[model samples]
Target: MSDTPCRVAVCWLLPELEQPARDLAARLQLPVATADSIEAELLLRLGGDGLSLQATGADAPGAVRVDFVEGALAHRRQFGGGAGQMVAKAVGLRGAVRPTVLDATAGLGRDAFVLASLGCEVTLIERQPIIAALLEDGLQRAREAGGEVAEIAERMTLIQGDAITFMAQWAAAAPQVIHLDPMFPHREKSALVKKEMRLFRPLAGDDLDAPALLAAAWALASHRVAVKRPRKAPSIDGPPPSAQLSGQSSRYDIYGKKKLG
Candidate 1:
C-alpha cells in the first residue's frame, strides 16, 4: 500500500504545536506553515483523513509505555541517564529488555512508538492492510520531519503481516520484550469512546486469539513478555502476572520467564 500525501493547512494552535507540527510535516514530507485559522479540532478532523496531527496534550516524543489514560507520557532523554521504572525495566538486564522488540499486534503503532521512544529498536507487525498503510504513512511523515523523535521513528520499523507467522521467523535476535496490545472487545457505547480510539476500533478488530498470541510471545521473548489488558479482565488464560502496572481501567502485565537481575 502507498503512503498518504501531506496536506497544508492553517493551524490555530501554531505557537504550541509549532515544533511537533513542523516535525509532523517534515515526517510527512510536507511544507510547514504558521496558519492562524487552524484549530486543534480542525487538525483532528483532518487527521481522520490519514494525517497524524500534532497538538497540545498529545503524547510527547520518546515516551515509553503509554497507558491510554496516562494521557501522554514519554522518556525525558533519548539515551541513558536513567529515568522511570518503565524505561529502566525496558532497558534492564544489560539492555536485554531493550533489544529489538517485536510489537506482534501493532494496531496503530502507538505502543511501538512508545517502545522506540524508549530506545528499544522496534518492529511493528500489523495484520490489517489499511491500518498498516496508515501507520506507514504516519511513520514516513515523521521521518520527513527530520527531528530527533522523527529520527527515532526511523528506527521503528513497520511490517504488514500476520504477527503469528512473523514471530516464528524472527529467530536471529529474539525480542526480549514481545510487547502485545491486542484489540479487545469494547462494551461501552460508541459515543463514549475517544475519537482516536473509536477510529482505531473498526480498523483493528478484537484479537480473539489473544491467548495464542501470548503463548507465541512467551515462546519468542528472551526475558519477559509484556501485555496490556483491560483492568477489569482476568489475565490471559487465567494465569496471574508476575508483576503489573495498573492505571484507571487498564494494566500492563509482565509475564516473567527468565529472572531479571
Candidate 2:
C-alpha cells in the first residue's frame, strides 16, 4: 500500500509556531487548527518546545518527538560505548576513520544522530512527511542549543524523500556507509518495540519494500551497507551479509563493498 503515514493534521500551540504550522498544512494539504483536540487521528503539533506527533483517543500511545539535547538520546550519548557500540563498529568507525553515513530509513533519526555525535557526517532520508517534519524540528532545536549538541546537529542534514530513487540518482559526494533500518513487524512481547512505534506502525503502515531498500543501499554505498534487524529475525531477501555484529537485542548485518580506512 502507500508508504506514508495516514490521518495527519497540522496544528500550532504557540503564536510563534502558527506560521510554520500553516505553511506545513498548505504543503501537506492537511487541515490546520489551533487546538490539537480537533478531529484527527494524529496531530503534527508545533509549539515552543518544538514539533511532536500526538495521537488522540483514550488508549493512544505517548507523543513522539525528537530531542537530541536530553532524555534517552543524551543518556545514550554519554553512557553508550563510543565508537564501540554495535552500531558504531558496524558502520566501520575505526580509530581514524569515521566514515560519512547516509541513513536511508531515518525514522526519528536516533541512530543517525548517534553516528553524528561520534563525528560522522550523516545525511538522513525519511520518506514519511510527518516523521521528517519532526526530525527537522529536532535538528533546528539542537542547532540552537549550541556546544556539542549544535556541532552534532550541524553534521546531520535531513532530506525528506524516497531513498531508493535518491541513491540511484545520487551525484553528490557519495557517502561511505549506507544504513538501513527498514520497518519490521514488532513482536508483541519484545522490549524493542517503543511506544513511539505503536503510533508509527499505524502511520508508516507495513514495510513491504524493505528488500528493495536493501538493494538500493547495496548499490550506492562505496564502502559498505549495514542493515539493522531484530536479533532473531530472518535476513532480508538478497545477497548474504558479509559479516554480522550482534548486540543484546538487535543485529547489524554488514554487506561490504570495499574496505574503509
lDDT of 2 by residue, 1-261 (tens): 154446778888888778888998898778876543558888888877888988877888788899999999999999988998888999999898999999999999999999999999999999887788889889999999999999999999999988998999999988999999988875677664577877788777657888999998888889999999988888999999999988888899999999999
The C-alpha local distance difference test score for the whole of candidate 2 amounts to 0.88
Q: Which stretches of candidate 2 lie above 4 Å from their native place? A: 1-5, 34-38, 186-193
- Taking all chains together, each candidate's TM-score versus the true structure is 0.64, 0.94
Model 2 is weakest, by summed lDDT over 10 consecutive residues, at 1-10
Model 1 TM-score, 2 decimals: 0.64
- CA RMSD for every model? 9.0, 1.9
RMSD of 2: 1.9
Alpha carbon lDDT at 218, candidate 2: 86
> Against the unseen true structure, what C-alpha lDDT does each candidate score?
0.60, 0.88
User: What does candidate 1's lDDT look like per residue over 1-261, in tens digits?
Assistant: 112222223232434555655665454444444444433321321232233433233442221112221234233343334425453353242543356677887766766765676667888888865456457766776676676657678778788888887877775788767888777667764333455554444445567778888888888888888888777767788366788877677777888877654
